[model samples]
Target: MARIIHALSEIAQDYDALFCDLWGCVHDGVRALPEAVAALQDYRANGGSVVLVTNAPRQRASVQRQIEELGVPADAWDSIATSGDAARAALFTGAVGRKVWFVGQPHDEVFFEPMKLIEDPVAIERVALDEAEGIVCCGPFDPHAHPDEMRPQLEAAKARGLPLLCANPDVVVDRGESREWCAGALADLYEHMGGRSLYFGKPHAPIYDLARRRLTALEKDIPDARILCVGDGIATDVKGALGEDLDSIFIAGGLAAAETKTEKDPDPDALHAYLQREKIAPTYAMGKLR
Candidate 1:
């Protein structure tokens, strides 16, 4: 039962800042969405702060570089709070133990890099799964493959009682037109197989706390009522906003494109039905960020 708006500006003035999702809202993984970029730029121009709250399983600096290469300029956002940073904080504190099994692409190696955030940090080591104390899953080794393919490894880990630290809780993402699996899929399978999986991203408290810190660093103490969450993931983004008791804008054009019948805009009836089925009630709904 959310109001459908044509542009973010329609409600921009109501919020002092935005907790924006990066992947599907600002860019499609391969490139920037020009209209979405313009909308964010306009919001910032009017003195509203923007914190890019992403579930990307990489540090903010690495994510900043990746977005810039994808055509997202520096002006569109003020700061970034990544799932990797939140998860990294937990890892360094030994949430999953010191010697853990690493599961992710080579690019995600930067996640293990040293950080000054922790005064007394655990010295982490990457060891073989059988020899390790816990598992750190940044993402699937192959995104295109089904989650079931990870059964053998997850099964062994379950019997061994190893805890899994899920960096990014997204099940899938569309890199351009091709959709691929993410770390969350493996975590989901692991939990189903009776293994314990820890989450730090959207719909969870850790990442939101990180995003608030990022926003506070900008000298803006935005109240919950004055902050808006923008994203495409119904489960992660909208659900997280609800959990945090913040107003949210659901970008239907991203993950729920088909379910909401979103072309230029989501079909009102279809969008309503989709939300009804999901049992999530965002503050507002729009086809895209623009």
Candidate 2:
């Protein structure tokens, strides 16, 4: 059974570094959570290094700007490692072709800059999968809704046996009071249609490996057991930590809050059952990061 705690302070001293999640644990999409921000600040003030490991489909600099815009303090984290960075690096070294069909929002265009790849806009709109050598999915074109509109394109890509590169492996993220689909959801749909996908984010080894490198740069000799991952998403954050053999702190009041909370408090039984269903056991469970 996981220990239920009210604040991250309870376990802060037990770890030397934190591999923290960005979206849910640190802030909602609209703004930073004051308590969460304070907790992170406090943790850093106590000499612990923090690496914001996010599945955001943009580079670390872009994500840092977004976090600043969302009111997160600059000193709250030591460094950042994003899935987009990992994906770009992988694509740069991989055997994938240069011509690609990009699927995602306008902001995601930043991912293509380093690759010097040509994007077929017409192919993306017309489902002309054969026109491109590969497909890069940063996220859903419209994250607020279902990805049903992408079915035709996915089917077409599958028929052509095109390889897909998914930057973010998060299926859904909490956006203020709502939830939205992410790139992982679209990649899952594509796989369901028998298309092959290469993922670069959480629940995958690449992102974790990138985060560890960043952490090591910040603080030398911080072992995996000394690093704790704190996040709300069971499949991404918690599962990713387990995959990397690191300890985790599950935030019950973030993405899973709706189903795991009773009134304003985290329902221990509900949270436990949910974790059991997901087949993950976090080292600690807390209502909020603070």
Candidate 3:
């Protein structure tokens, strides 16, 4: 197994573009990770493309606003993409006027409310999957609740041939205080049952393609070899980069490690195990971007 490094300031100088993860690498929900933010700022100062891709359930614009509010340096990235933006586009391009059902936490309304949606899901009594045209899912019914809690909905949506649009493509998240499942898990289940799903965020080709297009617009031609993805989660961050055939730098102190009870620090063994399971390894692994 490859060893994880505690600091990686040297590697920053070699990359032309930095594809970063936002929630875990740059912030811990409430406050920004100063080191990670600074690393990005420093990288950008040296003329590197910094693109922050998040699996957040909100649009890219909303995420930018949030980043500004969190004190993340405004110029940290050259572009941004979110699962929400992709999900919305997927819906708009799909069959229109399709009655939709949303299953997510309370805050997820921001992602769907702008669409002039048919109904607010929280108000519905006994959500009837058979009666709906589609489902706009932002998260699991309970982040921590087991998959069985979602089985009924997934089975019903699949049986009805309802398209599931997952705004937050993340299957799990470090909720600042604890680990909880996100919308991605339910969407996966629905897909497993033969239901089609549209994912909007990181690790997905559309999102990466959007970021690559922005990078090209910034410069003449950006080589994939020069682009590097930095993220915390194995599924979204590492796997996302792998799918795109881009090098990734894993952050152990980010969202994927949020459930730890001890003081936050990078764990090498855990990272190696994660990499082994994936059958692919990141170019580097560090505690934080700083």
Candidate 4:
């Protein structure tokens, strides 16, 4: 069972650091949540470190730029660990073969940029699906369209035995009241349709490893017991924390607001039912990040 809390300050002293999710917890896609930002700033001021662990399918630098534009200040976090960086390393090492087909928006083309870290990297080429050996997905070409629309392409890739490298494992994200489909929806469909798909983000081990590396780079050797994972995602954030054997604080006000009946706090009965359905138990639950 998950204990519902009113604010992060109630247990802030117990953790030395936080692995916080960005999209729905800290920000709502359009701008930073002021209360959430204040809570993080106060935590850092009191000597606690914050690592913004995100499943955004873009480079850390790119995420930084986007968050800055969306009103997230620099003082709120100590470091960043993005799904893009982890996936990029795998992509460069030939996780998806040389000639591949890409399925994403124009902005996601940066995924093909040269990597300086991988030694003797594979020479990747973005070619047509007919000429490609694998598929790389950052997101859907049209985020608003239904996932079923991608069936034709996925079937073709399955017949050719092409594996999909999913940059983000989130099925959907609420971008300021407008929900949008993500790359994971397509990858899930592909796997369901008998094609292979690879994931490096939340609920997967690779991104957690990348987050620990980010923590080490900052000289913070905080133990597992002293670290807390905070996010709104039940499957991605909370599940990832459980898989890593870390305590988690689920923000019910983010993605599961309706299911949990959250406004200022979650309705206990509703939250209990929702958690029971998902079969995931976080250490704590809050209406919002604050």
Full-model lDDT for every candidate: 0.95, 0.84, 0.73, 0.95
> What are the per-residue Cα lDDT tens digits for candidate 1 across 38-134?
9999999999999999999989999999999999999999999999999999999999999999999999899999878998999999999999899
**87, model 3: CA deviation in Å?**
1.9
Compose the digit string of candidate 3's lDDT tens values, residues 3-55.
Answer: 46665467766778877888878887777878877778788888787878778
User: What residue pairs clash in candidate 1, if any at all?
Assistant: none
RMSD of each: 0.6, 3.7, 4.8, 0.7
Deviation from truth (RMSD, Å), model 2: 3.7
Candidate 4 lDDT, tens digit per residue, 161-268?
999999999999999999999999999999999999999999899999999999999999999999999999999999999999999999999999999999999999
Which candidate would rank higher by TM-score, 2 or 3?
A: 2
TM-score ranking, high to low: 1, 4, 2, 3
- Candidate 2 structure quality by residue, lDDT tens digits, 1-290: 77888888888889989999989788899999898899999999999998999999888889999999999999899999999988887666652456678889998888765533323322222134578778888998899879878898888888878889999989998788888899999999998889899998998999888888897787567988799999888898888888889999888888888778733557988987888888889888888788
TM-score of 4: 0.99
* Candidate 4 global CA lDDT score: 0.95
Residue-pair clashes, model 3: 2
Q: How does each model score on TM-score?
A: 0.99, 0.93, 0.84, 0.99
lDDT of 2: 0.84
lDDT (Cα, 0-100) at 87 in candidate 2: 89
- The segments of candidate 1 whose C-alpha lies over 4 angstroms from its true place after superposition are none
